[model samples]
Target: MYQLNLARSLAAGSVFGQNAVKCSQMLVSEGKLEPESFNIAIGVAAKMRGQANLRAFHEHYLEKTSEFRANKVVRRFQEAIDSLSIGSLGNILVEARTTRIRPTTRSTGLDEGVRL
Candidate 1:
């Protein structure tokens, strides 16, 4: 799946419309769209800060998933849209990048496991 923020960072918001359209058209049939891809496209709409794209995303996802799942998606999608619209995404992105990643560790009964 194409990363929505990648277009926002690498190109411009204008490009996101084309990406979202293409993604939606590719999954025109029901049962083709998955949660991850639907989420990303909706996120692109939010991050692009376009009302049309958001509507398109809403319609497209509704076609792909159930009402129950759609409700959950819509709630989270609204949150993302609100975050972007209100300019909180900048701080969120910075916070995300600045957060420290914990090292991964594997345990062995012999106490010879390594950390990475």
Candidate 2:
């Protein structure tokens, strides 16, 4: 079940990431979005590829600008990120928690005599 859920999450994120790029391209072609608007989609795609563990909403800085003056592009990206299901997020959390390492106890040699 865990493997199935993870596969689905990856597939969904892949489709969503592609859709974002396509949407940005369409906007650019239609003159509704500036050429720079495509940068956000590119950034998202790069991050998604590099960090499979990251959720769409967890992607930071979709664009290079310190301040985003374009609301439409931002809105589109937000909508795309928001579409991810809660189950995917839960699965990611479960995977992360399971991989965390527990603290280890100090080992003492038998010849040295252990202190309690």
Candidate 3:
């Protein structure tokens, strides 16, 4: 469960997301992780990195598992793929960047001009 959560977190990251998905797949293949964990991680990767980025992973998983199509996450992902036009599929990064809200820094109680 810990590893699964870690994989999900990594899958949500922009830089290491693809590698995390690949590693999750490898772990499943090696019996180090559950198949469901791989599904969850891949689903997150597909959502965060976009379906285009994870297409190879999707294809490989589909080829390897008869149950791939039946998984709810994979089913929704397939639905999303089918419903979206090609152009919209490329907007995941743009959407992510545009929608993010940055936190504001809080002022310390000390004097404003004093160096810490």
Candidate 4:
């Protein structure tokens, strides 16, 4: 169930390119998904979106290896990191936030002496 949701979030983020980081962060840190999934999801997000800093990601993952090493379930985590670490991530296009402006409304009250 958790894996399914993680994949769903990754897929949605990859395709839509919105909430990718938030979804990835939630899934990776709290969803309890596989460590490899974390790497893969973050990698895809970085490629699809911007990873901010690949160097930081690599360092953080490497630091976690020893902690997860005892558990054999996360062996593939290294592979995911390796795949994401290859070459430059290339340029990233960030979508700009749009602001909506409300139309101004004027009301002429009984106090017409004041400007509307």
Candidate 5:
């Protein structure tokens, strides 16, 4: 878990970042990759637009236990990969951004004129 968290942090923020992907691949190859870890890798790959890494991770995920497929996060990651493959990633991003559940004044219970 520590390694997975470190890999995700490095992938998200480090200037020398491809190493993080390599670390994830090594974990997958050694059968040490958890479903959550794979989800993290998928997220990083999608954010970085690393098509090759995404494909590799997808293949590795498939080869793992069927129980992993039951994980919602893993399923979502797979859907993201599928969207990328079908060239609908841009549409998905636009829809997700436009459909966000913004906090309303009623929800926050603060006056609309009040500044934070």
Candidate 6:
């Protein structure tokens, strides 16, 4: 559990990719293909452990629909957490980040056309 948070904080872009180019790049630099550890650390710094703990409860337990009982929700949360380790999540985050490209906007000159 702690490892997952630590990984999220250290990995870049909040994604992981098995075949991502970035992973390759990291491997080239560090001799192993892994998400950026520094970025994960940054994530941890940005969101401290206390805040994360509180958020987990709120997001996983309180935020669910009425049909979802608290215990059930908590069990689900535990399942999910157990399924993936922090390193895996960070890797996924890195992959997700790599795929995300800022949307490009082209000036249409519509505002210029409507002169004051």
- Cα lDDT computed for each candidate against the true fold: 0.55, 0.48, 0.55, 0.48, 0.54, 0.48
> Mind giving the per-residue lDDT tens digits that candidate 4 earns over 1-116?
46556656666735434444454556667765664554544445555433344444555666777544433323454444446442222111232356799886676677665553
lDDT of 1 by residue, 1-116 (tens): 35534544554445655655554445544445655545445455446655556667677778999877777777777675665522344334324555589886656577675544
Q: Which ten residues in a row have the lowest lDDT in candidate 4?
A: 86-95
RMSD of 5: 13.8
**Worst window of 10 by summed lDDT in candidate 1:** 85-94
Tell me the tens digit of each residue's lDDT in model 5 across 1-116: 46655666767765325544654576577886565554454444445554455555666666774546535445676566665532244334334554579676444665555656
TM-score of 4: 0.21
TM-score of 3: 0.26
Give one clash count per candidate, in the order shown.
0, 0, 0, 0, 0, 19
Count of clashing pairs, candidate 1: 0
Write candidate 2's Cα lDDT for 1-116 as tens digits: 34434544555757555644554555556775553455554544443543443333233433533334344445566566556543353334334554578786666766755645
Worst 10 residues of 5 by lDDT: 85-94
Instruction: Report the lDDT of model 6 for residue 49.
Output: 35
Model 5 alpha-carbon miss at residue 3, Å: 20
Higher-scoring candidate on TM-score, 3 or 6 = 6
The best-first sequence of candidates by TM-score reads 1, 6, 3, 2, 5, 4
Candidates 1 and 3: which is better by TM-score? 1
Segments of candidate 4 deviating more than 4 angstroms:
1-32, 50-116
Query: Against the hidden true structure, what lDDT does model 2 obtain?
Result: 0.48
